[model samples]
Target: MAFSELNLSTELVNAIPNSFASETQIQSLAIPAIVTQRDVLALAQTGSGKTLAYGLGIIERVHATGLQQALVLVPTRELAKQVVDALQPIAAELGHSITVICGGEDVEQQVQRLGDCPEIIVATPGRLLDMIRKQLIDTKRIDMLVLDEVDRLLDMGFWPDVQCIINDLVNRQQTLMFSATLPETLQAKVTKFLNNPLKVTANKINSVVEHIEEKLYLVNKGSKTNVLIKQISEQKWPQVLVFIGARDNADALCKKLNKAGIECEALHGNKDQAQREQVLLAFKQGKVKVLIATDVLARGIHVDALPVVINYELPSDPSVYVHRVGRTARAGKAGLALSLVCHGETAHLEAIRQLTKRALELNQLQEFPVTDKPSTGENKRPKRDKQANRRTNQKTRASQFKGKK
Candidate 1:
């Protein structure tokens, strides 16, 4: 369905493109209620246009009042950037205004931006609270509050900040919370902060995309990297996103992939705002074909024809695996998730399998060795030095001996 059919204010739709289609179920059901001033608890997986769904409503509501009336709280800086980027056009369409405040940016500049009296404030919970404490931003004028990625906010230990923000605006604003899962803690927060919220869930809990083709490659630990290179070469996918588990891993993978002739960049928490913004813009503009990222950078990234997602290393948590693969198969677009499984990671893979409740299809790669040995020419030094290993072994043996004794 089109944005025009939603009965939104013409100015708001004009500010943003009406070409916007209902890409996800939550957007379809919740946008209408939200535009009509209903409190909402929407559950849509990451990368499902949840940002735009709530953004359009917030823009329309604030435009109606001719005052700043909305505050959107996100869990991370990356998400904060994505949310602001999505809403800015809509706000422009309505001749509305917005300001994004997050950590790792200049506080004075944000304070100055607030002086413009923006209609919407998109922020990370802590930064928002900090601004409020400094009396630089007013919650009193906010008429609608949105908690995007509600589950993640709780994960990041933002509950106290969320509560403080909510309490500050309790008198007059409507509250909306969105998450992929609604655990008991989130449920309690919703009850405490939202009054008569309209609940909506699109994908079933702990479920993978029904149409997404999932492939698991069982390769030897040493040969996995070679297998990844081979797959990338063979497919030559238009756009590919790879998920790694740590900042260091993301950097290392990107460097190796780039060295192997793939144009790639890494995104993670360690990047400065400018660097992160540049990398995302580069990826979106197609200057970069592959992006290696930690799951923290996974939630808010939007790309077109991103046909492939490679789990270069399996995620420790299942929810992360869901979010990683979710970068694709968005907007009804068919996509593929290929996980490269190595020997020691089987337990992690098993945990993920149990979490998703689906046995992933395992495939063996041709010409890729599945044995545990490293290639003959490769360095054989232990990841730790001999002395370090000796100390570790001594500790282990001492612990084992003590247990027996």
Candidate 2:
């Protein structure tokens, strides 16, 4: 359906890019409910136009005269910036101001910005809570509350802060929660926050995007980096996002790739906001061909036409694996996901297969053989073979002794 039919302001509609002329399913379903100021819980996959769905809804409801009419809570600082970037133009067109309050930036600067009382405030839970505690920002005036990536917010252990912020906003008129998947723990919180909310699911929960082709390479732990470099050199994908398990691993992997003559960068929490932005900017502009990142820090990243995603280390959570690979093949474009699996990660691979409900075949690279086999409780060698080996050793000793004699 056309975005024009969504009852948005003419200025806001005009602000939308030509590429987004037709509303995505999430936008079509969510815009109307949100426009009416109803509580909404939307479950949609990554890269499914969720930002626009809520951004336009926020613009439609926010009045230029109001003080902090809307509050958008995201999981990470990167996402906070992304949401602000997505809504800023429409906000300008509507003459509504939007401000971001996230971590890693100068808190005092955010305090100064809060003096203006922006109509829309996009923030990460921790920094927003800090502002509330310090009496820098007033939450009593906030009417609409949006929890973008709610699952992620909980995953990052922001539940306590989120609840505290919600309690402060006793006058909230509407609550909107959007996520790719909702775990049982979050359902109770959802019940507590949203009042008679409408639940909208644009796609199946925890389902990987259909357009992504998934492949697994089983290799030894030591050989993962070599295999990754080999694949990058062979495929020559223009832009690739590689997911590592930890911050240090991201940095180390990035260095290894660069030393192997591939242009790469690392995005993780250790880097400050400015550094993170520069790395992302370089990656987006094609200056950096590969971006190695940890899953949590990469929450807000949205790259267009990203051809590939590599899992250097699979996340322990099966759902996280889905989210990691979902970065590719977005907007109906075909993408590839390659995972480097070691013997120890067989369980992780199995969990991913079960969660995605797809038969992912394991392809072994000839150069990097899978030397390590998964361990079972019992020894794998047969008792007869063990006895025969012992007898052969005794015979070899006897023959050597006779020759010496």
- In candidate 2, which residue pairs clash? none
Runs of candidate 2 with Cα error greater than 4 angstroms are 63-68, 377-405
Task: Give the alpha carbon lDDT tens digit for every residue of 1-405 in model 1.
Answer: 767677677766556654464435667788888877788988876656788778877776777645356888888887788788777877776677788999988999999998888888889998889988989887778877888878778776898898888888854567888876566655875666767888887777657776578999888877766787888988988888888888997898888888899878999989988898889889888888888888876665677667899998887766778877887887678899999988767878888888778988677776885767433555677575879567667775555545444
Clashes of each: 1, 0
Q: Candidate 2 — number of clashing residue pairs?
A: 0
lDDT for each of the candidates?
0.79, 0.85
Query: What lDDT tens digits, residue by residue, belong to model 2 across residues 17-131?
Result: 7877588889999999998878999988877888899888988877422435899999888788889987897788667789999888898899888888788899989889988
**Candidate 1 RMSD to the correct structure:** 6.5
Residue pairs clashing, model 1: 15-93
Taking all chains together, each candidate's TM-score versus the true structure is: 0.86, 0.90
TM-score of 1: 0.86
